[model samples]
Target: MSEVKKIATRDSYGNALVELAEKYDDLVVLDADLAAATKTGVLKKAYPDLHIDCGIAECNMMVVAAGMSTCGFVPFASTFAMFAAGRAFEQVRNSIGYPHMNVKIGATHAGISVGEDGASHQCNEDIALMRTIPGMVILNPADDVEAKAAVHAAYKHDGPVYLRFGRLAVPVINDHADYKFEIGKAVTLREGTDVTLIATGLPVSNTLEAAEMLAAEGISAEVINMHTIKPIDKDAILASAKKTKKIITIEEHSVLGGLGGAVSEVVAETNAASVHRIGIEDVFGESGPAVELLKKYGLDAEGIYKKVKSFI
Candidate 1:
């Protein structure tokens, strides 16, 4: 078997996007003035005619992408997660979500990974905002391979898709695995009967680490990589709930309306008794390293392992 190496999601997006552009001539990339940060500059260099930088006008970029969706072209509006989800919510909701447009929102520097940029640049509530919109597919890839699969899946998918990528170079988790990223499908990475840890985005990597630690402690921990947060794999979650007595959720987003909230909604109705949430704890992020933000906000691997182990 090939060794699975960890890679950052944004890097995967950059590599996969250029590949997609080469394969699909209709694949166009538009940035709301954040081509470099969002890694769309590679596509710009490769396909200058197919790439457009909208000069910091996120609203116009959203409208233009929607317009392109109405036509035959496939558009990916690359930008910081905060601006793409916060500044252009209406356009995303009305123009893209409402029409179920085939536009892909390639959001980079998501969550506390914005780090030194402080709270203003961090997308704490981005998942909450996107998950609320109708007909929008939410994908928070865990690693490079998953991010690449998500990019290809978004192009194959018919409706609007939101891809949240981080700036940090995380340890590669999906690099050596033979995996197929499916929309609304949850990946069961490890099996455990004590507790189930369902995580998305950056936290999925932490979840894997936590699961390994838990295993050493004689605690069987089931880990689920729920990349698609919106159409969250309900059946897989419920299956875990039935098998495992406890449930834990981890995400690089707020505790309010993110993966935890989505999983809670499912488990609450399913008569689940033990539920724990690991996230930003309904607080804004601080200006620091991503690892520091995760620890301070109780979203890191050690934090999750401690909390999950308490149940056992």
Candidate 2:
């Protein structure tokens, strides 16, 4: 049997820009001197004229992208999630988000998966921060296929968008030809009647594996991949909640204001079902190997399986 393919979504973000640049001449990429790390250097190497290195000033890069948007150019500002969403919060909120510019924020290295970079660089709060901005679209792709598709969707979108990417090379689960990526829509990967496991970003493939473990013990689990967080698929969440009666949200972010919070809100509004959130437990991360951090935080497959089993 062939080994499962793995790729960092950050690489997908860069490759997607190169592909889109071939089609849209007005598409510009702005990087904060960290193009190599964020993978925007792929576009820089391919199309020098289309990529700009704005030094280390993340806030300035955002304003530049906002300005470029007014000139009818779709600008994708690339940087680490810590700087893009945290350091440039003011610029992102006022310059890009408040004015609703046609700018895409390619925030790579999100969450504790950033590994040796430690907690300071690992941004677990980006999703929550971006979610607060009105009219801001958020997409946290699960794999290479979904990440590439999300970049295309962000380019087509007319307003501010936050695209979250991870440093970890995760399994490419959505590689099938029949798979489709639509903004604001959730994809159900497995169907079960016991409980629903809704996951986003890097934790998605792990959640699927956990579901398989649950199946072995007669705990039928439904798995749903929620790529879009801001404009979440309410209908899908409602349907799964009503069917399963128990819901568990998994993400590589904080349990607050992220995917778990979003799912809980939907279930709460309609009282669809009970929700158990699995993510960073509202604490800071420490420096460690990416895989070890995930294990310690209980975000890996075996960890998720144990948590789900206990929850059941």
Candidate 3:
């Protein structure tokens, strides 16, 4: 069998910036001394003048990006999730989100998948934090294709955007020609009636595998890749809830105020179905290999399959 191709979404973020820069001259990338880690170094290498290294100050980087946005330049502030969303929460909320600036926050190494970085670096609550802002658009792409598309969409958007990327190299699932990516739309990967598996970010591929496992056991599972957490695809969620009646939300972030929470809010409003959230329970992550951490935390394919089987 051929080996599956894998690429980190952070790499995609950097490559996307380089690609977009060729077309949009006003595109600027700022990094908090993490250009290499966040993959923004690719942009610096290609277009030296367009990239800025803002030292280790994440808060100041956000403020600078906001200021640049006011000058008609689309600025993407790149940094680790912990610093961008956690350390610089005040600046992100007040300077960028409050004013609704067209600054794209490229937050890489999000969630427990940040691996050996341990609890302090793993930012599992970034989605929750970004969602609280009034006009902040959150995009957690599942694979390389989705991530690249999301970066382009973020540049076109005229408001604040939080683009969450991971350090782990995930499988390239959406590599087909007809694959489409929109800001506030959900992509249905598989259709079934037994249950619906709504997933975001790195857990999306695992959720698809779980659906296959459920099918082997004579259970039909619908799979939906929810790339956009904020301004979620409510109509799609409602339709799936109405059809399956049982929904399971999977994500790499925390269960509270993340993708699971967002889906639950919509379902609860209409009382469409029951939602079982699968993600990092309210706790800190431990240092380990990224793959092992995912397996131990029940975010892998086998883990997701076992959880869905028990839920059924």
Candidate 4:
């Protein structure tokens, strides 16, 4: 058998976008002139005419991409999540959400993992910001497999899509390549009946480890890998809630409006349960090592385990 080409989700974005551009001529790519850093330049190199470099103006680029989508063109807009979700939010809401435009937002450099780039470049709130937009599809892939699956799913799914990826090269959890991703469905990696640890992005692995620890201590915790933040899997959530009265949410984003908030909202509306959130605090992270920042923000495995235990 031929060896499979391994890929990081960020790199998958560049590769899959190029392949998509080649296959579909109606597909167009728009970048805010940060192609090299975000790897959107790869697609530009493969299909120059199909790529649009909108200088450094993200808001302007969003409006232009919306315009392109209106003309029956599928636009993959690339930019940092901070700018794409923070600066060009209104454009995304009106041009994309209101009209349900098929625009694939390649949001990169999300969370504190953007390391040495400092706090300004880190966008931990992209999920929260985008998920609030009605009709928006929020994506946070754990590894390259989920990333590729996410890309294919986004292409199949219509309406405004915010695809979030990080700068850090995390361990390829989906390395076995059996990673099955669903848009609105959360996957149960480990099933237990004591408690449910719902996680998104890289934190899913941490929650997995924490669940193992909980098991060793005679607590069988259920772990759900929630790759999709918006259009969340309420079915899986309710199932977990019924099985485990104690629920905890872990995310690489701020405690508000991200995975934690999303889970809490569902638990509050449908099923009643206690939810302990493990994520970056509301405070802005300072310049430091990536691992240290994660520990300080309480997103590490130990932190997750501790928080889950506290709730139960």
Candidate 5:
């Protein structure tokens, strides 16, 4: 077997912004004293005129980005997920979401993968909070390839967008010769008739590995990457549920109102199927190694395989 390549989605986001700045002169990047950690410093280095560090105030950063958007400038705000979604949420809703400002929020270090940051830094409720605000588009890209595409897609969009990214490096899964990304459309990586695995963010690669493990045990599993959490691919999900008869949704977020909750709402209305949610079970994450935390919370490939195996 060949060695797997890994890259952080935050790094990809930073690189994509620089690439986009070359094409769009109206593009501007902003951060709240976390340019180094969020990797937005790459944009600052490449184009200092297009980047700004707003001290340590996340709320003020949102206001500045919103103010720039009204002047025909596309602003991409970068910061930790906790600060972006938890601390400056009202500004995002009032200043941006209310008027539908074209401010793209690149929220990095999301979920329990923020290692030593503990529960206070980890943001597991961002999806749930963003979902409540009307006209807010939420995106959680799976890998570096998808993250790059998502940045471009969000740039073209005309309203508020929240792009969720992680701190840990993950394996590249979309290196196929004919890979393409479409906003609001789910990508089916594998085809099967027994059950369907619907996942977003880092869990996508793990779901694919679980599908491979299930195949060896005489079980055929289908995998779907639901990257756009807000405008979820309902057609793909319902079609898969009708064929597979069973479905499992995975994410690195709380099961209350994350990907699993969004999926269950669709499954319950359109096609009823037994759905199992694999993620943090309404609890806070503690400080530990990223991989170890995944295992303890049953978010790894082995844990996913076991859950699907028992469910089936």
Candidate 6:
């Protein structure tokens, strides 16, 4: 077995920004007094002139990023998911999404993975809120490699993008040289015929582990990394549905309107597969260890395995 590397997606985002700053001279970063937590402080350290600390005002930080975008500056705004997707939603909707500004919103510490921060900080509805915005592209990278690629992708793509990152240190899954990441396209991690496990963010690694466990028990479970949420790859979902005939969607988000909801919409339109969504129920998260919260919410590998077995 190859050595597994564990890294927080927020750390990957910070490193990617530092590299991106070298290529794009117009790149600017804005943080809402949470640069250390969000990891945007890396950019601030390297390129202090291009980074702005907008106090603790998330709403104003978003608008400021939007204003900078008008001047041909590609601004990557960093903050917790709670504020970026919840508090500054109006500014994001009106200033960025509505006008189609070229700004990338880096939402870190998203979902139950935020752990001890409790319900107030845990953002289970960010994906849902961002999906409601017109012409907004949502990217949820699974691991370090993909997170770095996503940052570059978001920078190249012209428009409003919400890039979701996590605080937990997840294992590096897509470390091979041939693993390519295309926005809005799903990547099949493991091929199988019995069932399909579609997941995004940190839960993707858990789903892959569940697939391994399922394989040992005479079940061939296909695993897919649906990194992009909005502008989701409907074709991939349908194709996997045709082969597996049964699907299970998992995420670190609410089961209501995250990856599961997006996959359900596609499956309902073109396939007859029975889809089971594994994620946080329609409830607020409580303070606990990140791993403990995942298990309690049935988003862990074991929890996903159990749910998938029953569903299949």
In model 4, where do residues sit more than 4 Å from their true spots? Answer: 1-8, 176-178
Local distance difference test scores for all models: 0.87, 0.96, 0.96, 0.84, 0.94, 0.94
Per-candidate TM-scores read: 0.96, 0.99, 0.99, 0.93, 0.99, 0.98
lDDT of 1 by residue, 249-311 (tens): 988888899998999899889786478788887668889987787887767788888878775
Error of 4 at 119 (Å): 1.9
Off by over 4 Å in 6: 1-3
CA displacement after TM-score superposition, residue 14 of candidate 2 (Å): 0.8
Tens-digit lDDT track of model 2 for 115-197? 99898998999999999999999999999999999999999988999999999999999989899999999999999999999
Lowest summed-lDDT stretch of 10 residues in model 1?
171-180
Local error of candidate 3 at 286, Å?
0.4
- The per-prediction tally of clashing pairs is 5, 0, 0, 0, 0, 0
Worst 10 residues of 2 by lDDT: 173-182
What digit string (tens of lDDT, one per residue) describes model 6 on residues 149-262?
Answer: 999999999999999999999999999989998998889999999999999999999899988999999999999999999899988898989998999999999999888899
Q: Model 4 over residues 32-93: C-alpha lDDT tens digits?
A: 98888778788888888988899989988988888888898988899888999999999898
Q: Residue 184 in candidate 4 has what lDDT? A: 91
Sort by lDDT, best first: 3, 2, 6, 5, 1, 4
How would you encode candidate 5's per-residue C-alpha lDDT over 1-312 as one tens digit per residue? Answer: 988999999999999999999999899999999999999999999999999999899999999999999999999998999999999999999999998999999999999999888999989999998988889889999999999999999999989999999999999988777988887899999999999999999999999998999999999999999999988889999999999999999999999999999999999897568899998898988999999999888889999999999999
The digit string of per-residue lDDT tens for model 3 on 123-216 reads 9999999999998999999999999999999999989999999999999999999999999999999999999999999999999999998999
The residue-level lDDT of candidate 6 at 212 comes to 93
Q: Which stretches of candidate 1 lie over 4 Å from their true place?
A: 1-6
| Poorest 10 consecutive residues by lDDT, candidate 5 | 267-276
